[model samples]
Target chain A: DAGITQSPRHKVTETGTPVTLRCHQTENHRYMYWYRQDPGHGLRLIHYSYGVKDTDKGEVSDGYSVSRSKTEDFLLTLESATSSQTSVYFCAISESFRAEGYTFGSGTRLTVV
Target chain B: AQSVTQLDSQVPVFEEAPVELRCNYSSSVSVYLFWYVQYPNQGLQLLLKYLSGSTLVKGINGFEAEFNKSQTSFHLRKPSVHISDTAEYFCAVWNTGNQFYFGTGTSLTVIP
Candidate 1:
């Protein structure tokens, strides 16, 4: 929602090309997450960062990778884009896991051609 | 880890009618429940949440949810819905790690 921003709101890339989606937050929240939304699958977490340089994988991390070098930025990369990687990616930020709620960015719609 | 399951993929209702969207979760330990609504081409907005101390939770836009521990279910309800309420609804549960698990969305369509 507020304070979180995702780059490349829309992108189209050819299969086998590298794609990276960026998530930036101004809230200074320590917890950041990346999720992909797909039909019949809802939202599946790809990766998350608890702090700068501390990252962990989620349920669906096979084709995705993430890096968080700074508290304000979390980047999700697809080593080689594939047709199955096409979906809307959303970034979320929270002060803590027990925090009231997570604030999400608008999202990036990626299409693999 | 927690898992959420939404029973319906689509629910079509007439305007001003009551509606209920079903959600069931599985977790070994205690968890928090939430419902979110996403309008077309927009990010998800929180509809309501159930943490503790209350089985019935009220949320924005006249939405409410009941957490039934016995059945391990959290179902969202609205007494009377409007056209504006037509949107995709998601049910989510927060795990012990504070990670959220979501269900397949249920799209609600309000008709005249």
Candidate 2:
């Protein structure tokens, strides 16, 4: 919460438009993640980046894309916003892959109509 | 792959009463367990985590959890809960991979 920040705390976009949410961290942690929180489903991982150029898809990554061109920033993009894509998105960072837990951002509320 | 299960979706208890929120996980290998609390319209805060060594771990807000390896359970408990404890609790498991699997969450309501 102190080192990581998510921009566009709240956003409403029209359907079929592209949307990108930014997650920037001052901690310079090696691992960053994007997750969506929904009722009954909890938090589902959408994507993760391990390094500046390395990334991977998570369980619910079909409609989402992620990019990490720099060590301090990770971005999640919606190719085309859909009504079903409306959800609260959280960005988290961890210092290690196996030993440490995550520090999460405050989260962004997104709505597509 | 690892998976976390929260059996109780909602639990109601009187203030100052003891409460336990159940959490179970499945994994072939050893994993790191954690409990996170999310208040309404807020990001998750780490309640506690069990990395290794101790089976009993204490966290913020007088919350604690025990790791039962035999049952693969990490349940959160508080002897005396306050109204401020009302929030959604999530159990998470981090496997050998870079991913963290979270449970569906248990909503705890502290009644007056």
Candidate 3:
């Protein structure tokens, strides 16, 4: 809510398609993360970046990839969207890995047909 | 090597009723606990956090949580809940690796 902004508040795309969601932060937080919210899974980490050109996979990172080319932007791309990939995606940022907590963006709701 | 347990999937209570949501971590001798509330379509907002001192941590929206190291539990409590409090509550902990782990989440339905 603070300095974080998620692009494409809502989107609907067909299966087997590719989609990209963006998370932009004005706080220059050193750590950025991508999380997906599902009905029964709560929020699961998808990918995270510790610095520019540095990223790591999350628990559910099979269908997703992330990139951090700069300090303020983290991109989440679904190479091939599927029914199971349809969920609300949230972007969170923190100053460091040991931050007490994170500041989350409003979130992007994506639907796949 | 860290995980969280919500224990409850859903909790129903009438308006102005007291409710408690249970959260536990696995074999964690030390942890940073946090509670976040998600209302409807809004993004999650931090309710409270327990970093150190004061086992009882009070947060916004009249929500509070107690961190019990012996039990590895951090349970959220509110004396009286309102319809507005009918939302998804998540308990999270930062492990030694500095990665965050979240519980399955407890959906609180405040019946009018």
Judge candidate 2 at residue A80 and give its lDDT.
96
* Isolated chain A TM-score, each model: 0.97, 0.97, 0.97
lDDT of 1 by residue, A3-67 (tens): 89899899999999999999999999999999999999999989989999999998899989999
Q: Which structure is stronger by DockQ: 1 or 3?
A: 3
RMSD of each: 1.3, 1.4, 1.3
State the lDDT of candidate 2 residue by residue for B1-112, as single tens digits. 6778999999999999999999999874778899999998888999999988989999999999999999999999999999999999999988777568899999999999
Model 1 residue runs over 4 Å out of place are none
By DockQ: ranked, best first: 3, 1, 2
Candidate 1 per-residue C-alpha lDDT over B8-112 given as tens digits, one digit per residue, 9 for 90 to 100: 999999999999999998874788899999998777888999889889999999999999998899999999999999999999998667678899999999998
TM-score of 3: 0.95
For this target, which candidate reaches the highest lDDT against the unseen true structure?
A: 2
TM-score (0 to 1) for chain B of model 3? 0.96
Best by TM-score: 1
Worst 10 residues of 1 chain B by lDDT: B92-101
TM-score computed on alpha carbons, candidate 1: 0.96
**Candidate 2: segments with Cα more than 4 A from true spot:** none
| Model-by-model DockQ, in order | 0.69, 0.67, 0.74
Candidate 3 C-alpha error for residue A4, in Å: 1.0
- Displacement of residue B11 (Cα, Å) in model 1 is 0.5
